[model samples]
Structure formats: C-alpha cells, structure tokens
Target: MHQALLVPEVLLEIFAYLSIISYTQTTSTQKLLAALARTCKIFHEPAMYLLWTEIHGLEPLLGCVTRLHPLIYHSGTWWDDSDEPWTKGVEPLSAHEAHQFLRHSSRIRTLNIKSEHPHLLSVIPAEACVFPRLKSLSLSTTYLNLFLPHMLHRCHLLSVDEGLQSFVTRCIALEHLCIYTPHDVHGTANELISDRIHWCTRVVTLSCPILD
Candidate 1:
C-alpha cells in the first residue's frame, strides 16, 4: 500500500483531494493538513503548501516565526543601556527571521485579515513582508492604508474601502476590485472609479455602488 501510494500521479491526486476538502471545510482544515504533513516525507511539502495558502489571520503565520526561537529586543534604561529590560511579549522578527518568514510567506496565495488589532499589521516589517504569490486579499478599511501598498503590486483581487483610490492606482495586475464606499462618501465613488479606470489595466470586474 505504501509503495502504491508513492506513485507521482497517485500522490498528486491525493494531494488535490486533500486541497479540495481543506477549502470546503475551514474549521478543521488546518489541523488535518498539519497531521497529513507529519504522516510521511512524501506528503509534507504539498500538505504544508495547502496549509499556508489561505491564511485567515496573522497569529498562525507569526507563530511559525516565533517557534523558530528568533531574537527579541527589550526596552532598557535610556541613560544606562545596561539596566534590566522590562518589555513583555514577542518582539518583532529579527532581520534573519524576517527573511525566513518571507520565504514561507511567499507561498500564500490568499490572505484574509478581519481582525482590527493595530499591532497585528506591525508583526512583519512592511518592506520585507512581500507576498510574491498572493492573488486574493480581504482587508478591513482601517488596515487598507497600512497593508494595501505593500501587497497591491501582486494581488489580483481586492476587497477594500473607498479611500483606496490613491493606492488602487498602484495595483498593476488587479483583475477584480470591490470597494465599500460609505454613505458620506457615496457621491465620490463614481468619480474616483472613473478617474482611476486606467489605473489597473487588467481590472475586469468592479463592484463599487454609485449612490444617487
């Protein structure tokens, strides 16, 4: 049975089935994929790739870096530099760790960040956190300004707020865009969309309601 499962075509089919099941069932997918990865050396790469493709939040991704036991900085007496430090919680990823994190992060194709935590966005350095394969992004209005620019260069689909007109111009490969214009800003949505129509050459689907 083990020898039969080692065939390349059979392994690909098995991995594909696991990917479909993982997408359809969100709650248990992570655990199941992690377990599958540990089952055998052959299953590890594909299972891990699927596990990191569609990340829902920053915690798990950050967990990977933290688990590597990277160095952490702490606040100390300004005058003495040698005084006992007192800062708590994990510090930002060191330069080396940031590089390692980015290597793994490059596999992510879809990222959905719904949490409102301000610090969550700071965990990874903006300049170093480029997701080369990221195609889909869902961000709250608050985080749009902070994270959009760093990711827009590669993202194909985006869900963001109306205030993104300035940033949308930078999305070269954006194919689908959904902007949630608030009531106060209803009148400007159309104008903004019209003015920026040529910003993203590949945009085929836009969902910004024009308020009358």
Candidate 2:
C-alpha cells in the first residue's frame, strides 16, 4: 500500500523533468500515462501539460482527447513525412481540432505546423492571430508561398515551398528556416527554408535546389 501511493508521485516528478519528445518514443509509456491520468485529477494535470506541450504522435494524441477535456496548449506538433504510425484514417490535421487549438492560442507560445499537410493551411487562420508568448513559429506546409509572407516572423524555422530565389522581403525575428526536398522529387522544387531572421541582420541560412 505504501509503494502504491508513492509510485504515482514518483512518476509525476520524473515525467515533469523529461523532454516532451521522449514521452512518445514508446507507445506503451503513453498508454500507461494515460491510464494513470484517468485514475485521478492529480495525474491528469501533468499528463495533459507534459504530454500535450510537445506532441509528436497521433495515436496518443487521439487517445488524449478521448480521455481529457479539450486542450488549449499550442503544442509544437511537427508531423512531417518522416513521422510514423501514419494511419491514413487519422488525417491528423482536422478542422475541428484546429479550432480547439486556435481557441487556446494564448496557451500555445510556440507552434510547429509542417508543410507535409497541404490541407493544414485551411485549418489554420492566416492573420489576426494573437499568441503573446509565441516566439517561434515553424511552418512545413505545401502552401508556403501563400502563408510565408505573413507568418514567417511568428516562427523561427520557416519552411518554404520550392527553392525560388525570392527576395527576403520581410522576415524580422526569423531564425532557422528549413527547405525540404525529397531525393525522388529532385528539381520538383517542393520546399525552401531560410533561417536566422530577426529584426536586425541575423544569420540566415537559405536552402534551395541546385540547378546543375
């Protein structure tokens, strides 16, 4: 009985210190935490904050919503093509969920919206967004050309589409922009990433396709 009471407390402290990414590496851990969280309100707070803050998995996220109430954290969820458990059924980015996320925009200081999901553009609002602490905005989307001119300053890793030599018009407070292009899709000009952009002449790294 003594160990049982102490176990959850121990887990809570340990979980609070661990990085958000580690929580999703093992599906079993996620399920375990979810189970513990459901046991009482105490477990729920950490489970939701620690887990939802850094979301990298879908199944666990889906499970989270089912167990917990609607979340308001702007978890830096980076769902690129490299991610796994790619169940087509999830469609990870949905309009319904987007609203849930946006509603809590204040809670989300840093958001990572990858370019892998072309449809995600529709789910997110363009201008007039208010994220007080939002210092980093990472966008890896198919609609880079459309949103870049507007939201680049909101993020550090500004992922773009195509390696086009466009003039760095306005990317104040920008840092670490990544342009992604797959091997098979060479010359296809998918995404371009320009980094280290801030109000001043911050170091910027621009990635584009080399025309050989």
Candidate 3:
C-alpha cells in the first residue's frame, strides 16, 4: 500500500471521485470500489461507504442477504440494463443474514423505491430501525405504508392514492413533501389540497404537481 493511501483524506478523495464517476460508469465504478474494499482492511470502510452511501432502490441492500433469490428476469418483467435486478424470497432470513443487510442499509441516506414488492418489506427483521440515517426518500404509494416509521427530512411520493392525510400526519419529522398524483388539471383531489393545508404549518415545503 502507498503512503498516500494511508491518509484518511486522500482515501476519501479517491473514493469520492469514483462516486462521481459512477454517474456515467456505474458498473465499472461499483466494481472498482468493490475491489478496493477487498484490497485491505483500511480501504474497506471508506470503500464500502462510498458504495452504499446513496442508492436508487432496495435491491442493493437486499442483495446482502444470501437466502433471498432474485426474481426480476424470471417474472416476465423486462429487466433494464441500467438498474439493479429486483428480488423476492420466501426462506427465513437468519440473524447473520439480517445483520449483513442492515450493515449496508444503515449507510444509505437517500432511497428511491419504484415498484412495490411486499416481500421486500417482509424480509426485514422485526423491530429494526432500518435506514436510521435516511434523509430523503422517493417511493410510490404502494410503499407508503412501509417507510412511515423512519424520521425522514424529505419525501417524494408518486402514484398517490387515497388516505393522503393519514400518511402525511405520520411523518412527523418530514420537512419537505412532494406528491405527484395521476389526476389531471380538473381532477385534482380535494382531500389532497386540504391535507396540504393541514400539513403546511408543520412542514417547510409542500409541493404538488397539480397545484403548480
């Protein structure tokens, strides 16, 4: 190992650059970071941190579990080359497997969940404060009931359904909320506007596409 690699700042800068480069070369960057993580003990923490700090979906975190099987390509759904493969499992997750999942889950600050997989939520261990440091979350209404327990600072909702008020009320720490509804110009839900007014006083920002 080089002396420069021994410096915390230097290692962070290197990993940070790789994180940025991941924007255009995601797979390559991930492979490089994974290699760095396995290179040595000192490189492990920062390398893993850079790899897991921000994620687009739940697949990466769930991938840590050995028992869960990926169901994306086999489900008849088109698997996008750019995204992580979706997974589903019915086997019981062992304590060690759950620990591995949580180890990476704790590092995530931003999460964007697209499709709903009830099995995804089912695999999580009970009474666990998953994503303890999570700050921003983007998820659809199908995921609405799953992440309400987190102390999120920002939330973006897509494909919103009924019960908007009840959902917003539970996010006590939410500072910003963006709701995207499928309703058109003349079909905006009255309950949505009322709920926004009700929550506007507490939350710093309440954004809705229809209102704009």
Candidate 4:
C-alpha cells in the first residue's frame, strides 16, 4: 500500500485532489496540509505547495515567518459590546520581516483581503510586496491606491474599490475586474469609472453598477 501511494502518477493524482478541496473550501485547511507534510518525507513538498498556493487572508501567510509574530496584533471593538480584545489589527511588518514575508509570497497565486481594516498590508514595503505567481486579488479597503500598483503587473483578476482612478489604467493584463462603490459616493465613483474604462482593453468580464 505504501509503495502504491508512492508511485509518481498516484502521488500527483492525490495532490491534485487535495489541491482542489483546499481551493474550494471556505475555511482554509492549510494547517491540515502542513500536518500531512510532516507525516512522510515524500509528501512534504506537495503538501506544502497546496498549503501556500491560494491564501485567503494575510495573517496566516504572514504567520509563516516566526519573527513577524510579535508585530501582529488586534485593534478593533467587539461587536457584542463585550470587553474581549480584538485580534484583527496587524502592525506593519518591518523591512526585514517584509523580506522574510516575500519569500513565502511568491507561492501565493490568489489573495483575498476582505477585512475592513487590513493594516497588515501597510507594513510591507510596496517594492517587496510583489507577488510573482499572483494571478487573482480581492481588496476591499480605502487604501486601494497604496497596494494596487505593486500587484498590477501580475494580477489577471482584480476586485477593488471604484475610486482608484489612476490605478485602473495599469491593469493591462486584467481579464476580470469587479468594482465596489458605495451608493453615497456614486458621483465620484462614476466619474472615475468613466474616465478609466477606456484603459481596460484586456478586461473580458466587468462587474460594476451602471454609472450615471
């Protein structure tokens, strides 16, 4: 049974199936994959590959670097009005930590950042934050302008705030774009969208509200 599982073709098929499940699941199961990696020498590389392939949030990815752990913190109020501390705010990773973070960033192909206050990203220097294998990015933050340029060269799918007028032009490789604009700020959002639509020649799928 061990020999059969060790066959090259069989191992590839097993890894592929695990990768699919990891990608489709809502909650990230990288920890489970990490555990599987320790079970045997042959499963190490493939298990680690699946664990790093698609990152749902920045915290787990940043957690890979031991030194950066102390810099991470939480800074938000509790929803239930309880005195419990919030563990969501993250301090900026230092230049050294940023470099360490970049080492793992290369393996990340998809990144989804949905937090209201994604302070963790601000710490990493824009130059060092480039993701070589990154193809998809979802950012819902007011600081879209800060990080958009660093990711533009490699990202093919993007979901960002509608107010980033100039940043939209640099998405030449984009095949899908999703813009989220608040109803109260529709005027500014519409103006920016209208001015920028001409620059998005590669966008095959565009999702945004009708601009008045």
| Candidate with maximal lDDT | 3
lDDT of 2 by residue, 1-212 (tens): 34654565666676665446456576555555566578776566666544445333223233334222222122545334465523333344466665443443443444565424444335555433434434455555443343344234433333334322321554444554444445455333432322211222543654434312
Per residue, candidate 1 scores C-alpha lDDT tens digits across 46-120 of: 777877888775545554565432322213112112334222353545666555556567768887765444443
Q: Which number leads on TM-score? A: 3
lDDT by residue for model 4 (1-212), tens: 57877775676568666646767786445656777789887887667666787776565656555655443433422122133422444455666766676666666777776544345556754333366566677775443554454345333223334545545544557677766655555565566667787577776777776554
* Candidate 1 residue runs with Cα over 4 Å from true position: 1-10, 19-27, 67-103, 118-129, 141-170, 186-194
Q: Which segments of model 3 are wrong by more than 4 Å? A: 1-4, 7-9, 19-27, 69-100, 123-128, 148-151, 161-170, 184-189, 200-202
lDDT of each: 0.57, 0.43, 0.68, 0.58
**What is the TM-score of each predicted model, taking all chains together?**
0.63, 0.43, 0.71, 0.67
| Quality of model 3 by C-alpha lDDT | 0.68
Q: What is the lDDT of residue 81 in candidate 3?
A: 38
Cα lDDT tens digits, model 3, 114-178, are 75555546656443457777788888766565555447788888766664554456667878888
What is the lDDT for 205 in model 2?
A: 58
Candidate 2 at residue 63, lDDT? Answer: 34
- Candidate 4, residue 41: Cα displacement in angstroms equals 4.7
The full ranking of all candidates by lDDT, starting with the best, is: 3, 4, 1, 2
